[model samples]
Target: MTLTNEFFQQLESLFPKAADSPWYVYAALVFQANDRMELISSTWRYVQSTTSKAEDQIVKARKMREALLKASVLVGFPKGINACTTLRKALLADSPEIESELDKDSSLRQHLSRSEKDARGMDFFSKIYAQHTDRVLQNMSVASGGDLSEFAINAVYGDLMAEESRLNAKETGLLEFLACYATGGSVWAQAKGHMYGSHNLGNGKAEIQGAVKICDTIEETLDIKVNRAPAENWSWLAKAEKW
Candidate 1:
C-alpha cells in the first residue's frame, strides 16, 4: 500500500509543523516506496535540469533534507541514513564546490554554512562515558573490564557511531544501519534492538524495513555491498509491526 494520509496524520500528531510543508512528507513517502532509486536519483535528476534554476531549488532541497531529518526523527522513521547520504551526495554532485555556494545562500547560511555545521562534533566519548555510568562500570566489573570496554564502546558507538553534524536521531539511526550493514558486526545487533524498542513498538514498522530495503537499493545504485552478515538476522521481522 502507498503511504496513506492516515500515516501522515499520525506523524502530524507528533510534530504539528511537519504538515506545514509537503517536502518532509514527500521525502518520507518516496523513501517508503523505494521506487526508481528514490531520493538520491530524484535529487540527481533535479540538479541536472536545475543548474541555472538549481541555485534557489538547491536551497529548498537543503531545507527539505533538514526537514526530512527532523520529521523522520519525530515520527520514528528510520531512513535518515539514506536521507543524509543521498542529500549530501546530490548536493556534492550538483556543485563540486558547495562549501562556498551553501555559504552564499542567505536562507541556508545560518544552518549549513561551514562555520555552523562544522562548528563542532559532540565529544560523545565524553558524553556517554559520563552518562552511562552503570553500563560502563558494569562492564568494568568483568574480565573485559578496564579502560578497554570504556574506550572501545565510547570510541565506536560513542565517538564514531553517534551523530553527524546536521543529522538527527533518525538520520543517525540510518547512518548507523548503513555502517552495521556494511560491517555486519555487533553494531547491527544494537541497531536491531533500537528498531524494536523505538520504532517497532511505535507505528514505524514499514519505516524500519524501508531503512533495510534502502541498503539493497544503495548497493544497486551505488554499486556497493551490504547485509554482509545475516547472523544478526536483521532481515527478520522479530515479529513485525502493525504499521
Candidate 2:
C-alpha cells in the first residue's frame, strides 16, 4: 500500500527535523514505521500460539529478550540502541516532567495496565546503543593513537549525530527539533513547551494491521535480519570517500 500523508505525518511526529541529516532520512522513517508494525505482529503471534493461559505471562516477560534479539539482528547494537533511546527521549519530551509524572500515576496507566510495562521496556532496549557508542569511540580513538583525529573523530561524531538527526526528523520529535533549531535562543526554549498538544498520529495502528503482509516481504523487500551482527565488532562503514 502507498504511504499516506497521514503516515508521513505520523513519522514526522516521532522524528522532528534538524540540520544534521540528509534527505534519505525518509528511508529510515519508512523502516521505523515498518519495524513498529513487525514488533506488534510478532507479539500478537507469540500470544496467540501459546497452548495455555498459564504460559502467557512467562512468554510476555520474555518480550524484551525477543525484541533485543530482533534489534541486534536488524540494525546491530549501536544503531538499535540509538533508535530506542532517541524514541524514549522523544516520548519523554512529548510529556515532560509533570506530564510524565501524571502519566505514570494517572488513570492512563490503569488503562494501559500491563502494556505500560512493555512500553517502559523501551528503556531496556538502550543497552546496546550505549555499548556500541562506546565501542565506536574507543576504536576511533585507538586508530588515532590516543590523540583525537580531527578527521576520524569528526567522522565518527558525524555518524552518531546523523543518526540522532535522522531520528529527530522522522518520528515523534521532529517538529520540536525543527522548531527549536529554526528559532534559536529563547524562542527555542518556548518551542519545547509548545509541543504537548495533540495532533493525529495516523495509522500507527493501521501499520500494525498491515504487518503480517509485510513480514515475508521484508527479507526480499527490506533485507532485515534479526541476528546479523555482533555488537562488539560493529563499526561505522563510511558511506563514501572523503574529498
Candidate 3:
C-alpha cells in the first residue's frame, strides 16, 4: 500500500513529533508484520524528511532498529529480518553518514552472563506483568509443559525486551503491543496483554487508545480486513488499576 503525505499527517496528529516519540517506527513495524514491505521505506523516509535535525534522525533510526529486533519475538524472525534490512537500506540511501552515529554493538548480551541475563529478564517480565506475573507464568507453564514459560523469561524477556539502553520499558512494551496488533485480530489476547504491559510501564489509557486507533487506520488504509475482537473486549482497561 502507498503511504501518502496525508496519511502521515494523520499519524502526526496522533503522536508527538519528537524523536523519542518515533511513531513512524511503530508504523513501520506494523507494516512489516502485515507484509506491506512497499510502504516501509516510504514511512521511514517521511519521518526523516520531517525530522529537521541530523542528530534526531539518528536517534529515531536506532530506535527503529531496536524495535524491529525486540518485536521479532512476537511478529516472527522472518518479517523482523526483512524489516531491519529494508530500514538499513533506506537509511543508507538517504544519509550514508548517519550510519556511523548508530551503535555498532549496543546490545548488553556480550557483557552479561547467562544467569545475569535471566535475572534481568525476570525482573523486566515481573515489572510488565505486575499483579498478573505469577498467573501468567503458571498458565504458560501449564500450556506448554514449562518450555514456553522458561523460554519467555530467559530468552525473549531477558535477551531482548529487557535491553533498555535504546528503547525504554514503555517503548519496548508498546512495540510488543504493536507487533501483536499488526498480526491481526486472532492475537488480540496477546495484544491486550502487551497493551496492559505498556500501561504498567507508564503509558496513559488515552495514549494506548490512540495507538489502537492508529492501528485501525493502518488496516483500513491498506484495505486489509481481519476478524478483530470487539472493542468491548478492551473496556476493562478503563479500570486498569484494579487489575
Candidate 4:
C-alpha cells in the first residue's frame, strides 16, 4: 500500500478536533519512520493544508519540526533527517514566508550541559513514568549494565522529549506512542509504555483510542501486518479509568 488521496482523507478524519495537536505531525512521521519517502511530500501537503493557517502557520510548522526531531531517537536519525529535509522543501514550496519563521538554532537543548539535560530529562521522565519510574529505570540498568538507562534518561528523555519550547510534555508523550507504533510490531512493548505515558500525561481514554484507531487504519491501508499485543493486554487502560 501506497498512500493515496483516499488514505490521506481517511487519516485526516482520524485527527482530533484541535488543530494544534501533534497527531497531525504524527501522520507525517508515520510515513517517515516506515521508509515511505515517496509519501512524505503528499503527507506533508495534507498536514500543511489542514494544520497550517495564516495566523499560526509558523507555530504549526515549528511544532511539526519539533515532533520530527523528538521522534528521531526512536525511528533513527537517518529517516528523521530525510523527513525534516523533505518537510522543509514542502514548506518552502507552499509557504516560503512561514519557512522563514523557523529558528536557525531550533534546538534549545544544545545550549545546556549534560547535567542540565539529565535534570530536565529526569523531571520529564518522572512525570510520565510516575510511580513506576524507579522500577523501569532499574530494569533498564540491569538489562544494559546501567549504560542504556543513563542514556535513555539523559539523552532521549532529557535532551529531546523534555524540550517544551514547541511540543509540550503531553504532546511529546503522545508522539512517543505514535513513533513506536510507526516502527511496527517489534517495539509494541515500548509503544504500550508510551501509550500509558500518554494517559499519565492526562490524555483521556477516547483520545488515546482515537490515536490507536489511526494507527490501525494506517496499518490496514498499507497492507502491513504488525504483531500487535492481544486485547487482554490493554485491559489495564480500562481499569485505570476507574482508579
Pairs of residues clashing in candidate 1: 50-54, 80-171
| Higher-ranked by TM-score: 3 or 4 | 3
Candidate 2: count the clashes: 20
Task: Report the lDDT of model 3 for residue 47.
Answer: 79
TM-score of each: 0.42, 0.22, 0.90, 0.87
TM match of model 1 to true structure: 0.42
Question: Which one is best on TM-score?
Answer: 3
lDDT digits (tens) for residues 1-243 of candidate 3: 467888987976786445357677678777878877767788878878888999888887888888877877788888889888888888778868777566364555667778977898899999889999999999999999999889998889888889898788887887788777777566877877888888888777555765666777888888878665587765554654443
Residue 18, model 1, lDDT: 34
Q: How many pairs of residues in model 3 come into backbone collision?
A: 0
Error of 2 at 78 (Å): 12
Model 2 alpha-carbon drift over 4 Å, by segment: 1-39, 69-140, 143-217, 221-243
- Please, what are the lDDT tens digits per residue for candidate 1 over residues 1-243? 233444334433333233222223333433422432354445444433533564555555554555454434323345655665666666666665553465554532333333323222224322323454456456654756466555444433343333344444444444433334433444565555444433422325555555445444434544554344665466645544554
Show where candidate 3 strays beyond 4 Å: 16-19, 230-243
